[model samples]
Target: MAQHETSGFRSFIFSRSGMVLLGFLAVAGYFLWEEHAAHILGYLPLLLILGLCVGMHFFMHGSHGGDHGSHRDEPREDDR
Candidate 1:
């Protein structure tokens, strides 16, 4: 006999029961979305603004390497 080692989560996700569970979740999610779509759409603008703010916070600050004054002390090439 041969034995195989696999994590429980990996094994379950590949099993027949896992397929059924995934299908059930898909159906449930579709119905949930259909039911609450109107409410979600009503807040779409607010959600978009919030997402933009969050994205800007991360991306804008990422270039500065978290040091706001690093470039202030350096002399510009045109000044030399």
Candidate 2:
């Protein structure tokens, strides 16, 4: 039998910045579609959401806190 070692899967989701850009792209696409169809821009909520995403991306992930290295000192419960 083969011995197992480390467990659990790492998250591969976008690390804040990628998600923000994704939101911006989606909203931009929607706006372009609306403009192409000669319709009113009715997706204001999407714009607000994109703004919030951008803010969070800059504040949460664009600084030293985004680095996962600072959390190394904290002892994990599994260590006990």
Candidate 3:
């Protein structure tokens, strides 16, 4: 059996620019919480639900529109 290679945290999770973007988001989130906490908190549930639905759609629709190569490259004996 072949062993699976795992990537390090920075390389796998986020690139250098991604780290900066995350930091910016953290700062923005803090400002939002400080300035508009009630409004942002009220919208949080809707944003979470929207993200979940979009993620589900992408995950359910696999590679090449859910084909997953179930159909053979060549004809089989079962085909008439």
Q: Give the winner by TM-score: 1 or 2.
A: 1
State every prediction's TM-score relative to the real structure.
Answer: 0.53, 0.31, 0.40
After superposition, the stretches of candidate 1 with alpha carbons farther than 4 Å from their true spots are: 1-4, 50-80
Please, what is the whole-model Cα lDDT of each candidate in the order they appear? Answer: 0.93, 0.72, 0.82
Cα lDDT of model 1 by residue, 28-72, tens digit: 999999999999999999999999999999988788675669788
RMSD of each: 6.9, 20.9, 14.1
Tens digits of per-residue lDDT for model 3, 1-80: 99876677656457877788889999998998799988889999999999999998888765656455767676788885
In model 2, pairs of residues that clash are none
Best by lDDT: 1
Best by TM-score: 1
Candidate 2 wrongly placed segments (more than 4 Å): 1-13, 38-80
Model 2, clash count?
A: 0
lDDT of 1 at 58: 91
**lDDT of model number 1:** 0.93
Q: Candidate 2 or 3, higher TM-score?
A: 3
- Model 3 C-alpha RMSD to native: 14.1
Model 1, position 65, has a per-residue lDDT of 73
| TM-score ranking, high to low | 1, 3, 2
Residue 26 miss distance in model 3 (angstroms) = 12
